[model samples]
Every structure is written in structure tokens, then in C-alpha cells.
Target: MPDLAYYASLPRTRGAAAALLLDDLGRVLLVKPTYKEGWFLPGGVIEAGESPLAACVRECEEELGLVPRLDGLVCVDWGPPRDGVDAVNVFVFAGSLTAAEIAAIRLPPDELSDHVLVAPEKVPELAPPHVSRRMEPSLRGLVEHRAVYLEDGREPGYGSAPLASAPRPGGPG
Candidate 1:
């Protein structure tokens, strides 16, 4: 948690936001926001009618332009933990996309300037405090082990491709 100043700066509630942490070969994925020069994890506020998990999945897809398998839920941070309505709960999840899948994405222009894969040491200097806190330690552990399991799950990796039936953002039956 950091300063509660931003909370007072915003309206009662900006709603909710979700975060995803993914690492590849010791490089953590990050976004250089167009709105602000600072780097950040791929995430966004949950729209009304969207579940937090759904928002986590959708934000990554929207920010990175790809749908990744959510490996696990890492941590949750709420602001009391930022002023007016200092309630921000950040859902940190372990998520990943293969090399081929990463190649297909194009960053959404309204949100980002560019995406980069950088080491943990570089993150603190490059990203915001909130983002760095969420990303750095996980990344460090991965590098130490030299191979991170990420989570307990069954994702086929880059081998056999199976069509996913995940829900599209802002759509309903």
C-alpha cells in the first residue's frame, strides 16, 4: 500500500481493477502507458456486470490483445491500504501466453504506448510502486528457481492448440 492521496483525488468509487503477473525467461511483462509515461502491469477497471475474474481476463486481453490462461490468484490489495472513497482491491493473478500467442497481440492504442519484457531489477525503476510491488518478488523467485511452475493447472503450453470458449468482453447470452 502507498499514499492515500489518489483516492481523495478520484470520485467516491472508480469501481474495480484487476492485475495479471506473467513472466517469461525471467522477463516480466509490462505496459508503458500512453496516458502516463510510467510502466504498469496489464490491467483495467472492472466494468459493471463483469465479475472480478472476468475483468482480470478481459483487461489482459484488452491491454495485451490476447487471452491468457489464468494460472492462479496471487494476492489482493485494497486501498485504506489510497482518500474520498479509498477502496481499491487489486486482484493479482498468475497468467501466461506462449511466444506464438504473444506475437499475435497488438496493444490497444487508447491504453498503452508499448509493451516490454524486462527483468525484476528494472521494474522498480520503470514501473509504478503498485505495479512493481505486485510484480517484483514473483519475478525474483522465478529467476532464482530458473523455472517457475507459475501455478497448479493443465495448460497445454504451445503444443496442441485447442479452441477456447472463454466469454467475449461486454457480451451476454
Candidate 2:
């Protein structure tokens, strides 16, 4: 076994959770962050001791002022270190909102400036490339009822096939 010091010396990856919320018309809900340049899914970093799902729920409420029923894991994307930043693992959970919920969305003026419901194909134009790449598998996962694992928003292999199996409750089969 590795010594405690050796284990502590291993690189650490940051965790973030986001929600893939869709409206009744199947348009995705995207939020514009006051601190960021482009639009993004409604979510933020995972705080210490918080599970991904819990963080997703909390961020949705904080950013949009709506409690969303996150259905299940849609994608687990591993982002490689880039631009001098450390690696980050982003967990995206799937959910949908009713017309009432959509109308009730209220953004925090200090954090989010606006929100919009756009077709999936239009997401690439508003969100950054990394976010856009992740959205593809996420949307497919929602329709296929399976979770996908990605590296930098794409499957590990050369093609679009999923590299990892859908996660099970107890363990992977």
C-alpha cells in the first residue's frame, strides 16, 4: 500500500455539478453567469463534503430559484488540465421543468444575469466549446436512459461510443 504521504502527494481534481434542465418543448435551459463570459448550464462548484447530486440541486435553486427534480446521472465528464488550471470532474444530472417552473425562474442579479431556453443545437453558439461537447452525450443519455463517461467532453476512444458502462446503484455489473 502507498504511504500516507505518498497518497497525500497525488494530484487532486476539483468537482463541479450541473443540471441539464429542459423545458416542455425540449429546449435546454441555459444561464448566463455574471462572472463568466459565456452561457452555461445552471450549476456551480461542489463544496467540501457535498455529494454531486446535492450540489446540483443546491446550485439549481441558487441560480434559478427553482427546485428541480433531477432524474439521474446524465454524464460524468473528466476535464483534463488546461490553461494552467487543475483537472476537474463535472457531474451533470438530467431534469425537466414544467411551464410554471420555467416562468418562476428568478436569477440572482449578483451572480446570474439572465436565463434562456434554447434548442440543443443552438447550445454550441452560446456556450463554450467544452460545455457544448458535453451537452451532446448528455442529451443522448437523457433520451437513451443511460449515463456516459467522457474525457474532456468526448468519449475516451476515437469514436462516439461510450467508454464506460452505465453506473449501477450497488456497483458496476
Candidate 3:
């Protein structure tokens, strides 16, 4: 028989997806929301039955008016429940944008108010503390060419180790 207590201890989390789009100059794109105070990455809570990758794709189109080809998963962070919301698994995918693509971005007035491309180092000043912390690993993942797993925007073991090896050509045997 299954242990009810053990099952109860398991985490029940919601899923959210975002895309990290970088311009040709290596700057990241941040979107200003009409309903939110700070800038954020282009994405939203994942709808039921939708894959995170698909949700990321849909969000980019809905929020930014551009269809960016998401390359790979960049960062996955487990965030604690906050503000009446349940604990959430945030998946951030990496994508690239040319200067022309960025210039053509048209914000959806109902959701986003504006968009800007800024240097990665300036993320702290432009976004919320939690968001900036989450972005750090994603940016590092972009440079390192690997995805990173995080808990509350920080790596496990205080950055001492990686949860998974970078994708290799051959299967793990």
C-alpha cells in the first residue's frame, strides 16, 4: 500500500514559462507590463494541458508580437509559494533576436506596455530582485551552453555542483 503521509509531503507546484531573448549585441529583452510595476521577461503562467515549450512560444507571440525560435531550456527554478499563489516551477528558454527583430517588436497594449533591450548586467536595476536573481543563472546558462537547475533562483549546493551534465552527442551509458 502507498504511504499517504509520504505522498502528502510531495510538492504540488504550478508551471510558468518564459523566454530569454537576446539581441545581436548580447543584450536581453525585458518587457514592461501594464499591470505590473517592474519589467519582466516575455512569458506567463502555463495553461493546463499545454507544454512549457509551447506556452513559451505562445507567450512570446501574444506579448511581444514576434515569433522567436526558442533554442533550448536555459533555466528551471522552483519558487516557493508567494502572494496567494502556489509554489511554481519556472522554465526559461533561450532564444536569439537580431537588431531588426527587436526593432519590430509591438507590445500588446492589453498586457505589455513597452519593451527594451538592455545589457545583461543591468538586469538588477530594471527588474525585481527575485527576477534578476533568476536571470543570472539563465544568462550564465546561455554563455555556458547548458541548462541550469535552480531552487528559488539559486543553484543547489550554493553553486558547488550541477544537477545535470550538458547535452552530449552520445547517450549516457
Each candidate: RMSD to true structure?
A: 15.1, 5.0, 5.4
Per-residue lDDT of candidate 1, residues 1-173 (tens digit) = 96689866866544444454555664667778888769877777878677778888888878877777776555555534343545565556666667876687689887788988777678889976655665644443333533222211111244354335444489652
Task: Tally clashes: model 3.
Answer: 0
TM-score of model 2 (CA atoms): 0.86
Residue-level error in angstroms, candidate 2, position 26: 0.4
> What are the per-residue Cα lDDT tens digits for candidate 2 across 1-173?
65999878987679999999998899999999998799999998999889999999999999989889888999999988889988899999999999999999999999999999999999999999999999989999988999999999997874454535555589956
- What is the model-wide C-alpha lDDT for candidate 2? 0.92
**In lDDT terms, which candidate is top?**
2
- How many clashing pairs per prediction, in order? 3, 0, 0
Please give the lDDT score for candidate 1.
0.63
TM-score for all models, in order of appearance: 0.64, 0.86, 0.83
Point out the higher-scoring one by TM-score: 2 or 3: 2
Worst 10 residues of 3 by lDDT: 158-167
